[model samples]
Target chain A: MDFQLSDDQRALRAGVRELLAGRFGRDRMRAALDAATGVDRALWRELGEAGFFALRLPEAEGGVGLGLPEAALLFEEAGRSLLPGPLIATHLVAGSVKGAARGEAVVAVLDAGQPVAHLGEADALLVLAPANAPRAPGGTLRDAAPVRDAAGPVRSADPFTPLWRVTDPVEAGEPLPGAGRLREEGALLAAAEQLGSAARTTEMAVQHAGAREQFGAPIGSFQAVKHLCAGMLVRAELARSAVYAAAVTADPVEIAGAKLLADDAAVRNARDCLQVHGGMGFTWESDVHLHLKRAWLRSGQWLTAAAAEEMLAGDLC
Target chain B: MDLAYTEEEQEFRARLRAWLAAVLPGLPAKPRPDDWPGRRAYDTAWQRMLYDAGYAGLHWPVDAGGRGATPTQHLIFLEETERAGAPYVGANFVGLLHAGPTIAAEGTAEQRARWLPPVLRGDEIWCQGFSEPEAGSDLAALRTRAVRDGDHYVVSGSKIWTSHAEVADWCELLVRTDPAAPRHRGISWLAMEMDAPGVTVRPLRTLAGSTEFAEMFLDEVRVPVSHRVGAENDGWRVTMVTLSFERGTAFVGEVVACRRTLAALAADARRNGRWDDPVLRRRLGRLNAEFRALWRLTQWNVSEAQRAGSGGVPGTGGSVFKLRYSHARQELYEAAAEVLGADSADLDREWVLDRLSSLSYTIAAGTSQIQRNIVAERILGLPKGR
Candidate 1:
């Protein structure tokens, strides 16, 4: 009945955090944000070398052997660092896509009729057709042909995330076995990332509240600000429980619910964090808005709130 | 990261389930809610059965004449008992949960022998006399004075919200022993006999219209100094210790019951065609997620307690659980009202009655506002509000 992170898992999380901090810390992240740079291929390959993409791959396959829970933890750190790329898609395709396990290739998934994120940098694009969509005759994974591009790269709310409109009458690639489950896994990972952002924003809020003074006292001493910070912690912790539990259970309904809560936590926490910081949070120079924008972007990714609600309601009704 | 129970814990669960199945049906029908004496008889008989079956005090220390079950085993006990429709700790709540544990932790050998056994056996039920009319949230401000006089403390002051006082044999009383001392330091904990002379219990009717709790008046009640659990002027710390006992798996049984109620609410919705409403269905679905997540949070807390080796005191996470669980409970009953429509106003309906009782969840134990302060000041390291 031990439902906490094991000693080994704790080490794994710490290791991932250290790696992300050393490689793509806040300074580097801000640099990319300022420059509006696309995905850093060097960091991508470094992450591959670190076995980030192949975390869940079998040890027999020359990959780091782990499970979804470990993957969730690692992705949580990635989310905390706001490490941007088609990480989930590339990780999902690690076993099937050549060179993906080593970060030599980048894979992106197109689903729910949304624009493909990081498509220009992606070596391979997997179109995960909606379950209700008519089955196409070809594979689900395909080469990223320019012909598939309906529109050029568009500005994204999250500056780190690049997006491209994929053409309609979208051609599906080779059949990906367990594609439905893969979507659920994607949702879980996305939820884990949101959990990380939620927690990070909470820390940022608390740190700011304790340091920022107003009316001759630390703003945190005020019940209004304190309660906001408290509420953020509650949301983040609750979402964390859901995300971690869903990772272990791998149940679709649970995953859907995890996504729903994680989205709420991330988006709402970021907004509250902004409120806590007062005027400073509104400036682009501050990281608070970045988190809010990113959370907004991520809320629409993988499993969305409306979709998750319907899925859970379907199970209940 | 394992959530599965060990083979031994699983075996414990199975054995307890079988025992509950065998014994529960043979018990007498439940007494009326207002029947204090009948309830005392029914609840104590159930506690005695648990004692005889070796299930009483599942989490108390072995040296204190308990089973000395691990935190996991204790959780399993709660989960299985609640699932099997077993009776709650009812009249024996204060004795088994609050006063008895306090005594075990701080009482003398003579005190243990005199008090602990009766509590474990349900022979002497206990009630809490801590909150006063003037010192509800700020309990340390209680003016429940008890002047020392030889071997006895001449106590005189009132305690409010004393649950089960009508049937309680003993009241776990807190008194201000040193008026000049600090607010937190001037207090002392005592086990005053509820039947003591000049002690009065006036049952207080809750919004739910139940007299399960009362206002207790202690008019020169001479409680022996030997009844004190800890040293004089240290009752505040003793009260804090008692509160820590409530953190980890305290609301676990309630979570199970809430889940059951949610299922019944869903069933009711389906029968009444309220399930067709997307808003209501989604609300229930969201609540399901809330409860499921709360259950996971419980497991996390228990695992943390096990790791910290704190003997099942779950630290500040209890405030987190309490803060959310209280609101979630209120939200669940609100959803039930939506499903019930106009019938929700009918007090005879179980959900209607529960909906009323759920109102106190955020107010009782610790108010949600108090919980927020605990979470902020204690857990988040926010500066204390002036």
Candidate 2:
């Protein structure tokens, strides 16, 4: 069984990396972060043109004929570049929502109990009922009425991702068919992003360790720093295997485990990466802290550690 | 990225499963851990069965008188065998996995003719004599000396951590042949007969109270120069050849066994009311993810080996796998102990024995600390530590 990425898949990932590097490089990302900008419409449309949102849509439906594995790879690149906005939500709704596949409309999904992300920039909103809530007879997606007045943007831990609290009781809307599947897919995608962050932070840590010197030698030559970098690689690689395997299997339990590991890897690797960077990692000018903050924010989104752990534990019993 | 096995690979698996099912029932009861002769006989008989069935050396090259199975087929072989409760390589481990392969790669034609067949046929057993008391992680610093005299090398000094030496027909011996040369450049590899005069094998008891390994002392042991695997003062490089084989799919069978152990632990927890504790359940759950990820990592490595056409050499990725799998194994047994509660202290229990043995995982093969150095310097391009 060939479980490694195919040449075509590698090309797809490289293509995404090239696209991101050219369009949303580090300088551009820093600029957006500093300016506190919302979703970039131009960049969003460009990603849509690249078939990012419609990656999993069937070719018969006039969309890119790909699978969740490919989607995971692309989102990994998104995560590596720290590309912001409601990327997963928009991509999840691309099959159902008009213009979403083409990136003309930005879709923001709201879980019943959770805050809405990118509520202001979203051209359309899809509200998902809480998993435990009762469902309507025939599940269907109803166009949600504008509830912008219900919430205002709140300060976000991740500067690139804005959050809003819904003060009013927004309608649960019709229960989307396969809501569970949607949530699992969302978790898997989020996990893929976390895998990307883990890997990126590992690279950042290794690069810094090799260049930064102390006590007449590169810090990397010290056992302490070398072990930290090595540990990051192990965690990232482990999470990567889980993420890719889950994408292929699409099993609920596997996805849950993948999320659990990916979340841990991303958050922990970022912290270790910061430690490797030493005092410079503490400064805002360095990208290390941003990764840590973003990882912290992402770890709590989609399927959280507690929720994923419970799901996995239930499987064991 | 297809995880599903090819039709041919599936057929291979089915055949192996059926063979295992048919043969396992007729096998003798397993020997006691302390019974070296019984273990040697039992393990070698199993190896003979595999040899007769053309299943021995499943991953060894065809030229080496093996089945020449692809990495995927080899993985399937391991998965099915471990699942069927078949015996491990055991006493033949050094012969089949280490010395035989190394001889195949670097041995002379006469060497292959004399040594390779017995190893594949289970007619001989081999033990590694590479690590000495003074040269554990720093293996090249071994003080084992072998002075050349005529056509024989008069060997001296001792080796530690040699498994199966008590019953081993041969020792894959590493000796310092040049006293004046550099540590790594002065070594040589030899096939020293265990029955040779002045060779000694003293069984060493592990923390698990098993005599699976021994301390081997070679005092003026005369080994023919023809027994050498490679050139004199080149044992270090010869040893490096075996390291590649060790890393790739070495833990594959162990991963399968660990998954089974984890399942049994969960079942035990459920029966004993330990499952009611959310903390324990979550701990087991996290371990479940860890092992699951490790299995996937194994697949990834095998796939990579297949792609690189390196004949199943998994490269530095093995270091990555070893670093985690070793610790994960320890963690798995620790979780088992937690589920066992007070019963964990009972020496008679299998879990207790396993938990004790698990302590060596991080320290054995290559210590976790050494593994990290390899990963950092090789995989991550970090500068080597002084």
Candidate 3:
């Protein structure tokens, strides 16, 4: 089996990394976090022009039509650079979103019963909108909702997207109540995000281990931290196999299992990465916290571990 | 990139599967062979059968009596063989796996032309005589001496952990040919008849009550100069090649088998009362995760081998695999024991012979601790730990 990435996928990842390395570097990440709107617009359009948003769209629809595997690699680079915006959600709903506006659009998967960021800022909103769930509604604000009236958006320690007040609360979408095509795609996408997050955190951990020193030596020399980093690499790579395999198969059962694995990997790797970075990881200046916060926040969104478990149990059984 | 096999490889797999299906002879219903030695011989005979059937050396070069398959084909062949639960190659274990290969690499043309074909044909067996009472992890500290006499080298001193030496036809002995040189630089490797006069083989009894390992004393066991595979004081290099092949694949078969066991154990827990224990389930979950991770590493290494030759990367992924896999293996057996409880018959019956065999994967191939050290020093570029 081929473990090497396709030339195009590799090129896509390299291109995205270059874009982020230039535009969404640490300096830009800090500025966007402090911004009132909580987004870096110029870079987002640059991504749009680069065909990042058109990854899943069919060739007939003027897009690359690559699967989640390719998308996962690109997002991993995004997480590595810690790029901003609700790119995942908008892409997830792109098939049904405004055509020409899909690339320019921004949206967030409702996090813990609240939409993250200002919903009104998006050209279109792609809310989970799970029917009949208890949540504080943002009420409709023209094309979007206005939930947060007076508040500064919180920027996670990560250099990426700043979290805004959850103004537009879409009720928890019923987990579709059944297993079919939609659940599969949703779970696979979740896995793709997790793969991105885990891979990013792993790189973060590796870099920290290499540079960070303790007692006149790189702390990575210590077996404890080495084992942790090694274990993190193991988990990230394992989940990757499942993720890539499921993407190849497009089988819901396989996808569900892979998603569960990838989710656990990202969540676990982020925590372990924080542990590896130790005090530095806890510092506000360190980017480790950003990944931890996002992993923590995302770990609960869409399919929470429990939700994925339930889906997995149903599908696998 | 296409992960699926090409047309030729698929056909190769199909043909090999069909041939194996047709030719694989039956074993005992309960496999209650007379004794360990008998079982070992049975395995040897089966290996010869496979050798004759042209499945023994799927990865060997065509010039060396192998199928001359590509690395991918070799991987497919190995995976398919494991899938078929093929028996281990018994008699030629060390010969074909180690000595013969060493000869092929460092031996003179006569040595390769003479020693390889017999071993390839399963007419001879070989055992490694590297470790001694003092040379455990510090293998270079071996004090076994082989001084040059007229036309032969008089070998002296003892070698421990000399497996299969008792029944084997020959021993691949590494000894100090020059005492004045550095510990690693003064050694020489020689292949000597196991039954040669002045050679003594005594089986070492382990706590498991089987004589799987041996201690051999060579009191002037004169090995002909023709048997010298490499230069006079350079057995260390030759021995390095022998020990190097000791690993690299990382036993993907064991990983697959353990994963199958893990799943079955989980399902068993669900059916036969133990499933409710959250602790056990959590343990299973951890093991399941570890298995997946280690298996991926194995696949990556195999892929690396497919792209690059057997000269694996200088990175410590092998060390990582050895470290993780050894612990996982011990965990798997221990978990099986836990599930079996005091009776432990189910576990025992499944692994009575293999239990002792399995312990050696870590201890024999390379100690887990040793692997960890390698990872730290070579792979991670860390300072040497005392």
lDDT to native, each model: 0.88, 0.87, 0.67
**Clashing pairs in model 2?**
none
Q: After TM-score superposition, what is the CA distance of residue B94 in candidate 2 from its true location, in Å?
A: 0.6
lDDT of 1 by residue, B1-386 (tens): 98889999999999999999999999899999999899999999999999999999988888889888877888889999999999888999999999999998888999999999999898999999989999998888899899999999999999999999998999999999999998999999999998899998899999889986899988999999989999999998987786766538898999999988988888889999999898998898889889889999998888887776645563689888888899999999999999999999899887999999899999898788888888999989999875
Alpha-carbon TM-score of each model against the true structure: 0.98, 0.97, 0.84
Error of 2 at B211 (Å): 1.7
Model 1 spans > 4 angstroms off: A131-139, B310-314
Error of 2 at B309 (Å): 1.9
- DockQ value of candidate 1: 0.72
Worst 10-residue lDDT window, candidate 1 chain B: B306-315
Candidate 3 lDDT over residue span A114-209, tens digit each = 435444355544444342232433112123344334323665433444555554434433232222344356556667777777877877776777
Shift in Å, residue A95, candidate 2: 1.5
In angstroms, how far off is B225's CA in candidate 3?
2.7
> What TM-score is obtained for chain B in each of the predicted models?
0.98, 0.98, 0.91
lDDT by residue (tens digit), candidate 3, B1-386: 33567798899899889877876656533233325556556666766776777776665666666666665676666667677777655556788677876887788878888887777776777888989899998899999988889889999999998777777888998889899998888988899988888999898876566777789998988899889889988898886765444233537666777777777666655766665665666566556645755655566666655665665344465666776677677787776655555545543455444454567667766686666567545654554434
Q: What is the interface RMSD of candidate 3, in Å?
A: 4.1
Model 3 accuracy (lDDT, Cα): 0.67
